[model samples]
Target: MSDALRDRCEELRAVVLELTTTTIEAMGKPSKLADVVTVIGKLRAIGDKGAAGIDNPDYLAWDRVYDASLQKMEDAARRGDAQEAWRAFADQETGVNLIARACTGYPGW
Candidate 1:
């Protein structure tokens, strides 16, 4: 991979890890709209950054999945439903893993 693409991918991978850590930490505490909003912000940032790798299908798919998950989390947070927010967050873990894994296969182009 070119340095730019590799850099973008690595940055995305790091952010994904950060998001996971933030969520896992939140899981140990009382779910707050603030906490969920924090995750939503991170997810938004991730989506923005992931756009750098948009030519890659994995990145594109990650964007799609993450957007959907972000929306779900936002809806729950907006409703002040901790249980639903947590459920949406739990459902998002798979896409989080996909995002991390996606960066590992960036091709040289």
Candidate 2:
């Protein structure tokens, strides 16, 4: 990968980690469902953008996983299931790390 692509991959990973951490922290309080959903939406958008230039199968696979996990997180948040939402968010985080590794040869987490 070029330096630019590797840098983009790192940026994507950082964004994912930040959003996941924020969502997890917000789960401890009530009325944070909207915030969590918003973060997940951002994550989905980021994943879509981040995957656009990649041709690696592993990166693409994990990108899809990240997208699906974001959807699951959003659904769980809507249902007021904090536990499930957290679980999905964790999966999203893992997906992000895997994608970073696949693309940049480093676990950006």
C-alpha TM-scores of all predictions: 0.62, 0.69
Candidate 1 TM-score, C-alpha based:
0.62
- Residue pairs clashing, model 2: none
Error of 2 at 57 (Å): 5.2
State the C-alpha lDDT per candidate: 0.62, 0.68
Q: What is the lDDT of residue 76 in candidate 1?
A: 71
> How many clashes in each structure?
0, 0
Determine which window of 10 residues in candidate 2 has minimal summed lDDT: 91-100
Superposed model 1: Cα runs more than 4 Å off: 2-4, 31-33, 49-53, 77-94, 105-109
lDDT for predicted candidate 2 compared with the true structure: 0.68
